[model samples]
Target: MKTKFNTSKFLAIVFIAGAITLSSCSNDDEDNNVVPELEVKTVEDLDGSQGPVFFSLSTGTAVQESATTWDIKFNSSNFSFGNGAEGQVIEGIFENYVVAPASGYSADDLAGIGSLYTYTGQAASGAQHAVLPTPGRILVVKTHDNKYAKIELISYYVGNPDTNSEAFINLETRPQSRVYTFNYVVQPDGSTNLK
Candidate 1:
């Protein structure tokens, strides 16, 4: 018995395969560039030894720290705060307690301060490089390799083991007071604009 080639069957198979492939490709648009949603890193347990603790923020990574690296207090009131070694300089008055942004706010946008770590208003006296409870301050930091980043302060209090599940350090005074939690994004090319 000789088997004859079926043109209709071959054409139907090709058409179905082509349709399937085309449908799959049609679902996605190649031209629309997507910006990744950066995260709000909760950095905790900072060193309270009256010095500058340096770190980097490249990809909006979360930070939870305890020990500090440097030994100089970088006040934000001056232009040349930390010289060059340290990257970030934060200074502001503390609230009754620190908290995250209310809602409907983009952490990526830094339009209010104009530039990173540039304060708009003066905090009260006894203000240092501590995280402010409200979202009115921006901390400008240079990465270990000289990359610039802006961190929005979220909170400055430690979380209780059984309650208040925000971002916990260990305590709320002195050494633990130096601890901080905030959201941050890095500018790889050291751009002045944060957004």
Candidate 2:
């Protein structure tokens, strides 16, 4: 009339549950090697001269996208870089007119470039803010979905370095560009504002 506790079955259930939980822990974020830190790399020989060179954050490839298709454009001024494409709007916050390598700072150092962007400057005035490329300038882009990415203009005209036209930039995009990595963000909370 009385039922006995099944320790063996109970242990088996717990083991199975734990395994499932651990297995699910691996998300696309991990499978794709996408971390919270910036996806750092240097892309050279990129010409943002005539029209903007289309760079896909999703695939990390630069293609010739017409005015109708592009992510960021390079101009003689600040408008040379930003989220100027479709999908998630990319915003740029002027960090410093002086460009410095992330390696130059301590691991915990977040000065100058440690701040967040609160304004979505007009696209017309987007990359239009002229900045002196001498010390090199750093722009923190609010990538798709308001996610953040920091980019430094290493050179505008290769080797000797000129302003605009052919430029090489050092980029540290965060997480992953996703399908169009630079084109979108994965915020499920539907929260469009960033603090």
Candidate achieving the largest TM-score:
1
Predicted structure 2, TM vs. truth: 0.34
Predicted model with the maximum lDDT = 1
Candidate RMSDs in Å, in order, are 10.9, 14.8
In candidate 1, what are the lDDT values of residues 123-145, reduced to their tens digit? 34333333334445555555444
Clash counts for the predictions, in order: 5, 12
**Candidate 1 displacement at residue 127 in angstroms:** 14
lDDT of 2 at 116: 17
**Residue-pair clash count for candidate 2:** 12
lDDT of each: 0.41, 0.36
- Angstrom error at residue 74, model 2: 1.1
Q: Measured by TM-score, how close is model 1 to the native structure?
A: 0.41
